[model samples]
Target: MRANKYEEVWTRIMFEKIEVLSNKTAITRTEMKQGVITLVKGLNAYFNKEISAQNDAEYINKVWNNFHLCEITMNLIGSLTPKELMEIFPIEKIYDGKKYQTKDWFSAHEAVQQLAQETPISESKEVFDFLWDYHNWDLHIFTVNVIASMNNINKMEKGRGLLEQFLEEQGVRTINKMDMIDVNWEEERDGE
Candidate 1:
């Protein structure tokens, strides 16, 4: 299964860090930004093409897997607030025809519902059109992916100490649950 852009970016960042550490070299800010931009561009291009095709069974399956992966990630990190969502996917940029007004609300769900009601998909043909436009979509995806990558990196750093402690307690060099099943199967077969 393929990971969402966030995870993909996070993995790329981690690998970059490892390379820097091994080489004892520092990465420039511009270099990091350029790398991220490249990755975002590539991902956006691939997703846009797949989404446009829409009828490819393999792409559809990948999309479903990506959806589930994103759902799990969101569950772990908690949902973004309505305000945050708006910041990432600004209504002004998305739809230029009519301004859709939204009010502040205590509940994120209610706020999202109000926003949805204000900008119904049926009324916003331009929304789909804008999304289909590669240049616009690429820029939007780049911004979102960058934000998600930073957020994931922060969260992973925060949890790193605990993960290390857990590994120490477990007395294992690495935790590979999938390999454990294979090991068990081999032992069972030997016994049989």
Candidate 2:
């Protein structure tokens, strides 16, 4: 899958695979819950030290947005059937100056109606499915193998591609379930 640049190939692969899965499952309540838990856990594990009690909510919300796409992905994996998945994932919470309410993730009719709205929608559910499935803990056994390989690498960026290749070679394509960890720094200090 060569391209004009390395990023193009990676992005294409990410988007195409995700789009297929997104079409399969739109969004539901259960998936939304799973996405929220995933976001909390991921932030806790990845950026725990950076957040304090005083700003936990704000930090978590920021992190959540960063992984909003991830939540969509997680929902796809947790709920296999689109219909079932839709029941699992909820529309995002929206606030209008005062109160907050859940918005619909699969608003086919409203989507059309709001097509010209100021805020454009990009099929996030699709992108989310890819990231979530790619890191699924149940179905993707290669996730285990990749975690083991992490022990030998100095940084995630340096090890991520190799781990993916190794897992692919071992016949692991979907990351439906897995978990593991290795020693890493609390932060990356530039010029180190």
Candidate 3:
């Protein structure tokens, strides 16, 4: 199918607006912006072709999921290290960990290429909430991985101590459980 120049231009602008609001990478903002633009162009092209032939739920879901992944990946790309990318993005270790530094953020440009052939997407608020969940999930995964990575499984406290030290060294604040309880905790929860 041929491209729609007008639609492409409009879609590009919409992606840019989303990036401004949802992208969190301070150091890699420009790179992220370029990445988002590329996604917009490529997705627009693919969807134009695919939409003409079919509109199956499976196909739609794939496109939708791919879109969500693209957004999440871009938002986290800066801090998603080479190692993390290879491992399907292991949760970032914030404290007692070496992976959460803002500078560690690098582009997941490769994923962009892969996802271009693929897609789900939703509201801006939904995207923000998805990212927030992923962030907290990463921290939880980091803690477990830290303990598991230890040579001696019996020495759990040692692993905990190491993580504690790492957390202290890095300025990533640990979210407290008690301080998280509120009227709208369930409605609009942050990290815990």
lDDT of 2 by residue, 79-116 (tens): 34333332333223333412333222233224333333
RMSD of 3: 19.5
Q: What's the ranking of the predictions by TM-score, best on top?
A: 1, 3, 2
Report the number of backbone clashes for model 2: 23
Model 1 worst lDDT window (10 residues)? 126-135
Task: List the candidate 3 regions with Cα displacement exceeding 4 Å.
Answer: 1-27, 51-192
User: What does candidate 3 score on TM?
Assistant: 0.22
Show model 2 residue runs off by greater than 4 Å. Answer: 1-6, 13-63, 81-192
Point out where model 1 deviates above 4 Å. 1-46, 49-64, 70-78, 93-192
TM-scores for all predictions: 0.24, 0.20, 0.22
Candidate 2 weakest ten by summed lDDT: 134-143
Error of 2 at 155 (Å): 19
Candidate lDDT values, in order: 0.40, 0.38, 0.40
Of 1 and 2, the candidate ahead on TM-score is: 1
